[model samples]
Target chain A: MSEILYRILIQGGSYKVIFNGLLATLRISCFSLIIGTILGALICMLRMSRVKVFKFISSVYILILRGSPVLMLLMLMYYGIFARSSLEAETIAVITFSLNVAAHIAELLRASIDATDYGQVEAARTLGFSAWQAFRLVTLPQVIRIAKPVYQSTTINLIQWTSVVGYVSITDLTRVINNIASRTMQPMITIIIGMLIYLGLAYIIHGIFALSDYLQTRREEAA
Target chain B: MKKFLLVLAILLVTSSAFADDYVGFLSRLKTTPDEFFMMMKNSWSTGGWVILGGDHSSSKARFYDTLTQMQLALNSGEIDEMILPDFVADYLLKINYNYSRCCISSSGKMGLCFGFMKENAALRDKWNEALSSMLNDYSLIGLAYKYVKNIPEDESYDEIYGINRKQLNKEKRIKFEHFKDAPTVKVAVTGDLPPVDFIGEDGLPAGYSVAVLAEIGRRLHVNISIINVNAGARTAALVSGRADIVFWYEINKSLSVQPDVPDEVILSMPYLNWDKFFHVTLSDTE
Candidate 1:
């Protein structure tokens, strides 16, 4: 299978296209993960607020994002929102995916915050801690611990979902494979290469997640 | 009443005279020049008369001989209506010319004859009329037979000789000949060759294999059709009697060691030569 893929990639300038596409995909996924996580934390705080209007708005936001498919959302943002505009497709993909991931991440973060031991927050409050200070000291740390596994998986999933950027003509890994197959007239060879590359990238992501999990466990054991 | 009767007789005589002229023209041109030239003349005369009256053919033919004469004729402004067959009119009018002529031989094979003219509206209209008339007169079945019977089998030996000899002995050759006429000996090819084989435009088939097999069908007098199939299903296409030939396959050395092909199939000689290349670009730093 690798041999077939190797032949196709080498023939049609597909290898370079795939390499560049993979790099772009990684860049977008990583950027979105960071941005979405920060945004998610902020949204979670808004959700936890005492204000009724704030909670309702946050609920509506999450409902809209979670209710729609990523593909439909991407298209809406790209064409519907930016009609007759001259924004690049890659920019649209990044914006759309980051916003989409933020919605789910916000829900996960809110759950983790709610599940935290209420006694810890009360103890901090009893010791004359302000609301912000208590959140910084006790609540935030515990939420991170509970949410880390979910966050890690979301990042991995974001990486996979980035493959759909090819639909907007961003020349992602899948697009490169399609182009090669068309030029060489060999679908079997190009598709096999695309699958191997995807698997390899997934393995790298899993390794990084495993390392982070191990480090977190060690820190807990030390404490 | 007498004048009315005379007018009717005159109309009948004129109609018969025109028919006689057409028949005389066909007889004169049939034995003289190439078939294409004769067909062109016939098409021009018939199409011109049908569309516009007057001696357009003689004037058009004369105009073709000299550019100055054509210009003079244009400037003179004596001609009322310019008559042209579809193709020629299309060129004159600067319209998009998208017509293609496929020569199908008697054996049910197809071959491309000519194509790809730029926009020429006047010429296109003229050519269209001529083509329609020509199509009505010439039978596709007759053309297919003529194309196949003239295939120069002796010249094709260099391409197929070695493979055919290796695949079949004298007895097998005789058997193959018998099988060629077998009612069930249907040939099918996958209509999937990237850009060339399966083009997106007009949905018309264009490719080296399509061209070659169309000729073969004409030669064999068999009907041919293309089916789109994936790589894995290619062999199955043959075995299931859906296709008599698989057009695309790589020459892999591993086939000798771990042969995956079934025994019922026979591979044909390689018809195409391909070159492999690795393209490299210098780094930005350099």
Candidate 2:
């Protein structure tokens, strides 16, 4: 126990770096999540549009962003796209990760929409419901429910992927852990703690989804 | 139980793919594209990473993304011998018993210097002046002896090499002074190279570069902030204006060690020349 403590907390007072790194990770993840969601909704709308041009553009965007490696995308964004621009590495990382997440989330939303029962929307229209009302009443709920679990998975994945931010000069959680490991020469212990912390973050997101599911069930039961 | 296991598998696979690189798919995510291509070309070898001799000659040498991977490959018997910087090899020999180290060759070494923007000639000259003073007075070599040449032979009381060995103190970090109204220079330190440009466990930059920068800051009365960057993005930091100066390792054209100033970014005078590279292999008996 003391050995673990020394490795994580005492040895070189590494916990400070750990905490700062965690905060950087959280900040980047949060920024990526928010911006990615908004951008994803736009792509989803574009993919579902009646205009062929919009559909083609959305298809290409998804194809490129989804197909390319995130690490490569990040480096290109930093060293190529925004190379001359006076943007910080972390901001460039957020932009890159957000684009990648937006692609995946767009696909996720489209799949959830496809999974929703069109029959219910048709039935709602027959029962004198407007298009918006039918979507709000029948289609949206099912889409949200269907997207929940996968959304949780995607969020967890994004959080984990943020570890690569260190590659771009950001001293994130993973880098801090690496710093500690390098400083202390206790790779096993330091990595175990890092994994546990990441696991804890993943579980927290998992728990949030689980709670939403339970609340959703209660609401359905009450209705 | 099934869900727990599924998540665990995902953790191992994904984290290894993109994060927690110490134990990952050995060659997949870490290395530069060039190094990765090298690994692919030599796909038969279970382990491959590059280690340039101190003499700046690398042929048939493998490349690694991080030092930790080198250690992993060496221990797993994937590689015959691991080549490393002389200071680091000596430090590792003291702590690790099974390891035996030898200098590979010592000739035609490159100069390590501070890189700055093309327009920032004034800032470049300030650093050059400070470096020249250090070189003339031999204070730079003295700092290297304090940090690099003086690794403790005892394997006991081992933690990280962040603590200065001679003083046996972690608290007294050589830090840059930030004056009340002085111009602040954001210098990037990778902390990848230990005992030289390394960060201590105290979360402070303390090593040869830090000591030299500290003295320069004191002499010039300029505020200097040492920012830690990954070794890969030193140039990115400089070009993006995120850092005013960065440590650059250059193989120059001159006979003796001289600053190889590139056209786009000027380089300060060379502070250290790594004339010796050490190759360490596991002792058979151990």
Candidate 3:
């Protein structure tokens, strides 16, 4: 009986419930990373800007988002800010996560940019390289190398945090596992399976980052 | 990077200013009954008591957010037994025979009903009217049985709930009134309690309360939207206006207990009541 129950949960069509949930998690994480990258760059510029107002707003944004729990921010965004709106929970999750990632990535970019050796850029300029060329050739590569691991960590944390989206009624991976386990009254094996899947997901993300680093190194050597 | 660290430090310090009592974190952890009683309790519980800090005023029993979590904790030996409503225990034990239920010594009784914000008093009344009509015809009781008594014990659980067996129970999943011209009201359900409140495998709200909501929607002539949420977040969902109505338990006079109901919530006339509590443990414990 236990075997049949486990089989029906995994091999049977009920597994599709878990698969669809994984897809939702992947969609939100990927969307947040893409939008966050763009927004992060903009926010990074504002943080480093000479304009006092923009700098103040950017600092507060970073302080508010980075200092508080992401789950709390997601709830505040969903229930407090957009409470009256007819927006889907998924939409709110994406928007909230994107904003959170933006704050972290912005600070990451600012710190990395600040840490770069300006002497190399000056040397590139002296060699008749334009400002953009100097940044592209001498500074950007260094910044990426310095920021690669932290950025990957931030993105991975964002993915894991998406588990909390179920609080708002969005059926992400964690919620699916809980629903299945609770409904069937078979949580031991179910929880083990869920844990294995999450670990696998984290490994996949880690591998992607490793591959990106390898490719970046290869490009630099080839150049 | 040093300046960045400094800024973060300032933020941390400033956040403490917002807390009225900032004696630091260590002072906040409340310990009770001195060290020896705690030692005995810890020895009794195999370290679970230390985690729970037995007999603490501020904390209650090890609170689990969902039924699954509670079961996991039990299996892990973190908890000995789980206290649950009689029907919920019945539903759980029906699926998994590995678990056993024991009688709990409690006379507390509570009734399940829909809760709305004070501002939505009229909406609450409308639902009450529809509920009365359903009760008058015995359809409400019948609806509760759809997932519980209606499910034949011989059949597979999947087939009963249409998990992997979609072709089965095509008519079993209740469809609510989706009137195009009528105003829509969003109702929140945790789907944590199966056969009573749960989502079907096809990712639609199933079970008794959903069926009741469907019948009420028909009588009220309003479109009903069901939102799935974690059980712990039900009240938050309602109070935030994400759900116009959510499940709220009303403690009966016989129970003589004031439930931890929110001040803003206005409960509807209860549609279902249960007086029994059960202590559930692994079957091996029997």
Residue-by-residue lDDT tens digits, candidate 1, B26-118: 011112323322333344333311212223233222212111122223333322122222222222222111112111111111122211123
Model 3: per-residue Cα lDDT over A1-223, one tens digit each: 5664554365436778888989999999999999998999999989999999999999999999889998898888887898889888899999999999999999999999999989999999999999999988899988988999899888788888899998888988888887777667788777777788888888999999999889878997999
Give stretches of model 1 more than 4 Å off. Answer: A1-3, A220-223, B1-193, B196-286
lDDT of 1 at A97: 86
Model 1 chain A poorest ten-residue lDDT run: A180-189
* A1-223 per-residue lDDT for model 2 (tens digits): 5754664576666677788889999988989999998999899999999999999999999999999989888877876788677787788988998999999999999999999889999999999999999989898888898998888999999999899877667889888877665555445567778999999999999998899889989998999
Q: Pick the candidate with the highest DockQ.
A: 3
Interface RMSD of each: 20.3, 2.7, 1.7
Worst 10 residues of 3 chain B by lDDT: B21-30
Reference-based lDDT, each prediction = 0.49, 0.72, 0.75
Arrange candidates by DockQ, highest first: which order? 3, 2, 1
Q: Score the docking of each candidate (DockQ).
A: 0.01, 0.25, 0.43
Question: After best superposition, candidate 3 residue B151: deviation in angstroms?
Answer: 4.1
Off by more than 4 A, model 2: A1-5, A79-89, B1-59, B95-98, B102-104, B108-111, B117-122, B151-171, B180-182, B250-266, B283-286
DockQ measured for candidate 3:
0.43
TM value for model 1 = 0.46
